[model samples]
Target: MTERPTTTTNAGIPAPSDEFSQSVGPNGPLLLQDHYLIQKMAQFNRERVPERVVHAKGGGAYGVLQITEDVSQFTKAGLFQKGAETDLLLRFSTVAGELGSADSARDPRGFAIKLYTGQGNYDLVGNNTPIFFIRDPQKFSDFIHSQKRRADTHLRDNNMQWDFWTLSPESAHQVTFLMSDRGTPASWRHMNGYGSHTFLWYNADGAKFWVKYHFKTDQGIKNFTGAEADAMKSVDPDHHLRDLRTAIASGDHPAWTLQIQIMPFEDAAEYRFNPFDLTKVWPHGDYPPIDIGKLTLNRNPENYFAEIEQAAFDPANLVPGIGASPDKMLQGRLFSYPDTHRYRIGPNYLQLPVNRPKAPVHSYNKDGPMTYVNSGDPVYAPNSMGGPVADPELWKGESYAVAGEIIRSAYVLHPEDDDYGQPRTLWEKVLSDTDRAHLVANIVGHASAPEVTADMKVRVVEYWRNIAKDLGDHVAKGLAVNGS
Candidate 1:
């Protein structure tokens, strides 16, 4: 027979008895001197930290990213070398949902990855879609508030959602995607992931290239129809989460093929559109994708709260050869991600076991809440104790000179830059006849809500007309709008 291990307090003291409370008698009042009982209750009360402001509900697994092709010419990052393998943690989430919201909600999924490389932790935070609703970071909060519940009613209002989307012309492309059946992914394993923002990849020779990342699912793309997703809410609110956990436990691990689109550093200056715009995508014909590696999630986390919930992914966690670009959303996130982690998980969140880097951490950052690690003497830099020093050469990346009075303005448009151009291509050239039909139906269902004003409905029609005449006509016909 196997021996059962004894239960202990967090401080490692053997618990006297966990089944009962210390009391004067079986029916008497409980004693305050019951330290073990108080300890258990107090710890349980504080078990949950504040949920994420955006991606509150999520699930993740440990995995290995195996490089199958050589991309050393584009990036000197060690993770890109052929045959190189890096361990990673991937969290799949719905953008608008609360911690307890249904997993099958019609929303864009957050595909955030944290790779533990030799240099340090590299976080690739992105969405399933290749483009976002807005390009500028200044409008991000308003955009999220519109999707979230109303301030007064505390209930989601379709009017607020449409009002924001119709007013912001740049939101056309992402809105078209959200109203389609593709919005409700069937399962995390069946959808594709993208590093939507453009990044700078530099090599050993100081050569620079602009890059975008796409992770195509090996299991194939699958989505639930609008009606099906609605039914799933009543049938099983946790359907997507349950599916992923069950599949992995049954040895049916999921995988994605990593592909990259590389653009020469000089091409952005004359490109048809502002390449840094988060609302735009680089046409495949212009910069074809190069298959680079495979990412397979084979290990399930032993403790969901400790391993997955506590995991922090920051865009600012860049390594030597990889660096940020001028994309406004990406740039804002570089500060926002770490800031949120510090607020949500405390100042020393990085020191948590899950967020800790595989590589040795040597820096001057010290002393905060939950400080566990010790830095022996010379806590500050420029010390005679021979502490670590920053190397400018080790962090060589692309740099360009810009001269102008600092002022607020939109991106300097290239010849082909316009809000509706790419969305037009997406509606006409990309979506099939069936997809177009579903897209229109989904729009009518959401926009025809009683709360949505007639004026807002007319504006919604105008928004689609800019994308394509047929899309506008279909929406108008469905809503019974006779040019009013």
Candidate 2:
């Protein structure tokens, strides 16, 4: 064999011993002067970083987004150009569970993507479902608190979850999807991913269009039944992660077709429902999907902690031609995502290899913990020395006038913007007979838990009843309560 490399400490100093603590005697108390032993123990103590507030458990892989069709008429974003192939990272996660929680639990999955382009990094942070429980950001923390363990008993409480869902009428659409078998996806590759928010896309000629992203899995939709998912919790809590790693390793790479629905910028003003509403979707009949590209994951990460765990995605990382819409939840995330990363990771989190953009960074931001970039000379702008300057007109997106009164309010309702309309459509027209049965059974199983009180069950019945008369009737009947 070739000569084996010598073991060393983190600072590259040769370690005196690899398997022993430096004690006064072999069996006596240890000495602080043993720098190697002290360093080893200290590094071990700090090995783990703080877990994320939400989406704590996740796995990701290296991928490429290949643009197969032209969408340049809709947007001038470099990554959207025809035949452009951009490297990307995709992280799949459970929304409410902790780092150690089982992956088979009934919960929404995070489908966050980070695209590395010549311009910069663009993060599309979204979920598996197109629609969400609530449209506004003000109730976000309250929603998470209800899903998390209770303070009183430090246990997950069904009562708290149902109480929040029943009280918030806006939750009907996502709750319907969650109660269906689609919630417990068989694996990350089998389910679809969506950039649920409507985003603004502007062309080089300054024409603006509204767009939504859908990543349809080529592996096909697959899910586990309620009983099957429960069994998976004990059989293999990390089933989803394992499946993805194994599949990629075996050369069975998973791919998704990227389709987008585009609407004329002016049409959103007169749409039947609030198009910006997170609880609703733009009807496929009105705006059919146009195939734009394909995303395929072929590489497993060599180091999970450095590549996946340290990866940070922020919705605010938009390219010049692609910009934010009036969606409230998306607007809220633009601020929250970067802020959380700063606190959880260091202030210089962007300097990490996974999050660092492939393009050169010439930011004025300087001096924080773990900052590796020197960025020497003329850090301040408008200086006598040569420095980077901003060009306001270069690849800029279109801007709209903002002239609204400063007041606290919900979205101004459109002609058909009732809370129950889309959910009612989903129950009546979308789900098949078997899917409907599973949805009903799942809701009844959760709502009829012993922790849930009779009064809450009455409200839960009323909540589902508002979505569909038959659904509420069945849930009420299952809970042995008279129809409210």
Candidate 3:
């Protein structure tokens, strides 16, 4: 199976020798005229691509999504066709960390999946947690800046993070989840993945439904205690990444059950909660998830940089039957995600094998760096020379009626828009006593970090107190931050 032995330059010219570079004599000055050596040195100097702005540290694997049930009644997307199996890749990573940061850090994990379908590439870009820190896209840049290093000392300041969270009340629900044990998952295999925002699913009949995605792990949920996570950081920084590769390499393939909760198209208007709000979840009691398929990751990537590093996921990459909802964050992401990818991976990123669709792409966009193929077909539309033309009958997207003023203002108020309700409910009902204790400890530990200023600590306590009275008392006691 081995090819004949050969050494060549990047352009495939026969190399003189990889072992020794050409020189004037045995002990003379090195020759700069050796083009192959110069080529090698130049390529070596440009080996790395720009690191991702966020979710920098990650690992990915090849997998299959097998449809177990007939969800065609909900959507005409080919991947959801009953008994269909599609090739896919899922990448998991720690947010708010650099490429070399510890995987054991207590932060939300990015759960981005790209499904190669016959129609096109559909990406469900999500995270482990069902909620995010902020809803409006305007605050996204500032919020990320707070989590990242400071401008003055280049140090991560907990005060800056809390300051942003306290100022933005909507961060409570996600912050509560972040401080819980679930934040530090045992491995990428054990935690669940969620399409946190609500999406729109359209049937062949043109009937639409508001939907939410949940990928429950088959391995069952497992998480590390805060103390254990901190200790593991010192022992093995890439614990999660190592565990994933080792498990797959040993043939212990991991899997998740894909389930979605669908809401009637008209329900968005009359529901008690704003159905399009990313901060809220459609209660299972109201719209229970319907089991759809299974996802199994059986193959590890041969080259991490080629496959995983180059892999890009965007919320805007929707197919015919799958579309977006009016969720503000989802709307913002529909634009922002692809824009960042265009800058990071280039406009021709989809040409990369990892991100490209298995289906035939008849796009007029023809040129960019590293673009090797030209179809010889005409490039522009509305031409008599027979270019690719749109056929509305073949694949028409779902459309809805809209009647609203175009303005830059706050969200329309709902009866229960306050941030404290969900987190308070989570703290009071969902978490057990031990869970509550750990959550309090995590908050006190992080909120009381060395970088947290006294004023910021006061605001943090206020933020907690607003969530729940007893919860605030516990955090205050843990941090010894005095009265209201």
Candidate 4:
């Protein structure tokens, strides 16, 4: 059999040689007429797209979400309909890291999922931890700025991070968690995912239930010590990514049992804890997780760039049954996430194969750069020709009565809004003796950074002291010994 010959073309027409461009003479400079060379150089220069501002370092997998338990009473979404299953893509990332940053960095892990249901795309954008550093979105930028490098040194400053945390008392709960054992997960498979903010679900009968998503890892919880995590960072910078890919490839598929804590819509008004506060969590004793389904990641992406990098998950992508709540962070993210996608990816990014809804999409949005799908029919609505018409019966989603002043006022925080309760609970109730020891060690190590001042260190120690006198003393002892 004859082998196929290498061919280059101006436009599919064969060219003589790709190695050398046409020139005036053998030793002469390349001619300006070498369109192929020019084209190649131009395309190469424009090869890369912009990276995400947060959750930049990530690993993703393709999977199927199987509804194992009946939650039809809570949500009428087809994905949760009795025994229904849907294709899903999940991405896990470190919030403070760049694309090439070490996977084992001490940061919140982004646990975002994009579900392609028959109804539409549903994205549950969340993190590994249940609560966040800040309750309000207004302080979000400032919190992130503190986590990032300082302006003068362009170096990650412990002072900035600690200063922000000390000022924003709301950060105590998440800060405590970050300094705990769970901060450095063993791998993506060993950690759980959480819908950090409250969401809403409406059943077939138009009854709404506030919910918090809890994805418990089927592999069981596992985490690394501070020293172990730091060692792994040096040994394998992409350890988490590699672990996820290898596990899936070896048929050791990782799974999460999807559970939801549902509260009646009326309860939000009188709940003990502020349900809308991103910094607080609804106690399991009050609202327990009713099993909804199982999410299994059984397949690795064939190409990271095509399948994972281009994947966009937005909290706003809600279906008929699933809806948004008054959680300030959730509300802010509903607008910001998609807007960021539009800026990072193109305006028609949803048209990308990775992000496109599996179900048919009909919209007036048209004529953008890289618009792969042509409506073929007229793009405008109210046309003489019948295009897609909105079905009020299907489109009219669940609604609740809204009666509030149109003023920019803060949501009333609960009386128990002191950040100590949960952290104290975590310290005394949740963590083992070994875990507590490690937590102190981690906090001391982080606090001992040369850039962090003595005052800031004392403030952090005092902050923890507010959580639990014992925990605060232990951390203070470690700080003192470490010369913080």
Per-candidate local distance difference test? 0.91, 0.93, 0.89, 0.88
Please provide, for model 3 over 168-214, each residue's C-alpha lDDT reduced to its tens digit, 9 standing for 90 to 100. 99899999999999999999999999999998888888778888999
* Number of colliding residue pairs in model 2: 0
Q: Name the TM-score of candidate 3.
A: 0.97
- Candidate 1's displacement at residue 469, Å, is 1.6
Angstrom error of the Cα, residue 453, model 4: value is 1.0
Best prediction by TM-score: 2
Score candidate 2 by lDDT: 0.93
lDDT of 3: 0.89
lDDT of 1: 0.91
Model 3 segments more than 4 A misplaced: 1-4, 394-397
Q: Residue 232 deviation, candidate 1, in Å? A: 1.4
lDDT of 1 by residue, 1-484 (tens): 9999999988998998979999988989999998999999999999999998898888989899999998888989998899999999999999988989999998999999999999999999988999999998999999999989998999999999999998899998898888887898899999999999999999988899999999999999898988999899899988887888888899999999999999999999899899999999999999999999999998888898998889999999888788899899999999999999999999999899999999998978888789998666788978889898888887776565557778788856698778899989989998889989999999999899889999888998888998998899999999887673
- Selected candidate, larger TM-score, 3 vs 4: 3
Candidate 2 lDDT tens digits, 55-112: 9998989999999999999999989999999999999999999999988899999999
Superior by TM-score: candidate 2 or candidate 4: 2
Q: Which residue pairs show backbone clashes in model 1?
A: none
Q: Write the per-residue lDDT of candidate 4 for residues 1-484, one digit (tens) a residue.
A: 9998868663676766668888989998988898877877887887667888888999999999998888878778888887888999999999988899999999999999999999889999999999999977888889898998788988999988999998888888899899987999999999999988888888878778898999999999999899999999999999999999999999999999998999989998877778888888899899987887899998898989888888999999998888888888888898999999899888999999999999998887888898878787677888878788877555344678878778776555466656778888988999899988998989999999998888888898888888888887888887773322
| Steric clash pairs (candidate 3) | none
Top candidate (lDDT): 2
